[model samples]
Target: LLSRLYRPLRVCGVVANDGQSGGGPFWVQAPDGVVVKQIVESAQVRMDSLVYRTIIDLEFLKHVDF
Candidate 1:
């Protein structure tokens, strides 16, 4: 089930995960057949009257053949 959803995105050579802890849990294989395990740490800091910011780029999809 996971493979089906990831296959299309993987073919494009890009993948992204967003979650608050444990990093979404998944595996990715690069176009070169190199498999990689990713673990994105969840935010663990808080500030009074402060805002945290994060930016993600989706431009890779534009270059994807599929």
Candidate 2:
């Protein structure tokens, strides 16, 4: 059921990529101050901004232990 799918986890997760794959995870802030995890593709973020790219790299740490 959707309720089972929506169950909260006791902890957040982080996974490292030694540079092979593309997409990564990030904490995106909502207008109301709620921050949620999002899986972002490399081409989807602003590659021109160093800050944004770096932040995206940080976000890349979470996900992919599977």
Candidate 3:
């Protein structure tokens, strides 16, 4: 018998609140019908939306830990 892995096989860096850090996360549908998580930059996001602005304006007093 084989044991199934409960946790994700890999975890990639997603969008961070800080302007200086990493890229953002987006959904990608695979040809096999599985949705994949991808990390993207600001260029991928629409700067015209209020939602995007809200995310950029969010404050962070300290470094967050996952």
Highest lDDT model number: 2
| Clash counts for the predictions, in order | 0, 0, 0
lDDT of 3 by residue, 14-44 (tens): 4346557556555657687777666656676
Best candidate, TM-score-wise? 2
Ranking by lDDT: 2, 3, 1
Q: Measured by C-alpha RMSD in angstroms, how accurate is candidate 1?
A: 11.7
**For candidate 1, lDDT tens digit of each residue in 1-66?**
576467645322333533223322224466878666443233432323244222112344223331
Q: On a 0 to 1 TM-score scale, where does candidate 3 land against the true structure?
A: 0.38
Off by over 4 Å in 3: 1-38, 61-64
Q: Candidate 1 at residue 48, lDDT?
A: 35
How accurate locally, in lDDT, is each candidate?
A: 0.36, 0.66, 0.57
Q: Provide the lDDT at 53 for model 2.
A: 71
What are the per-residue Cα lDDT tens digits for candidate 2 across 1-66?
585469875554445766676666666786877676666677877889998877766643554453
- Best first by TM-score, ranked: 2, 3, 1
Tell me the lDDT of model 2 at 18.
65
Candidate 2, residue 4: lDDT: 40
